[model samples]
Target: MAERYEYLPHHLLRRRVRDVASGAEGELMAVVNENVSDTVVEHWVELAYIRGSSGREFSTSVDNIEPAVAI
Candidate 1:
């Protein structure tokens, strides 16, 4: 099945693409997907940091790591 684009609003994602790339739309899309993956990982890392700071332990957990799969 095809993926839905609603998870990240198109306009916001478009802006992110502009912020991260200077290339064709197709190329930018690839970059955006990669960016989304990185962003998800970053969020998890940040959570871990927060938990550690609060005297709570947390393992690093990313929603998804596969490039072609949506979380």
Candidate 2:
């Protein structure tokens, strides 16, 4: 295993992530940009800024994405 991405800045760590809701295969992507502390969430949920391969950037809770293991 490489490393767990939780509890860290997205830009500072390897950004191979996948959209859990998309339900599509092969959507692994790298973080093109980030502002880990830029968003405010309910109940103090930490959000990460992510820019996917489609060039869509958004701030979302870490639960929305999962680390895409490299094979």
Candidate 3:
């Protein structure tokens, strides 16, 4: 059986998210699917922070991303 993946909507784009393992926070940029032979094998979430012209960006498994909690 294929695993189900949940994707965020356009309105949720740029929302803040945190990595469950690393505890790093960033803006949710996009969701990517890795396909093999017409089947999706993995799901990834692109994260980044923009400031002027320089910022850090990275991609990780969607399972690691979660909505950032306010404190």
For all the candidates, what are their Cα RMSDs to the real structure?
17.4, 9.4, 6.6
Between which residue pairs do clashes occur in model 3?
Answer: none
Clashing pairs in 1: none
Report lDDT per candidate: 0.21, 0.48, 0.57
Tens digits of lDDT, candidate 1, 32-60: 11122433342212111112223443322
- Residue 63 error, candidate 1, Å: 21
| Candidate topping lDDT | 3
lDDT per residue for candidate 2 within 1-71, as digits (tens), equals 22223455454244566556763223323332333343353123455555666666655555667776667
What's the TM for model 3?
0.54
lDDT of residue 4 for candidate 3: 46
What TM-score fits each model?
A: 0.15, 0.41, 0.54
TM-score of 1: 0.15
The ten-residue window of minimal lDDT in model 1 covers 43-52
Clashing pairs in 2: none
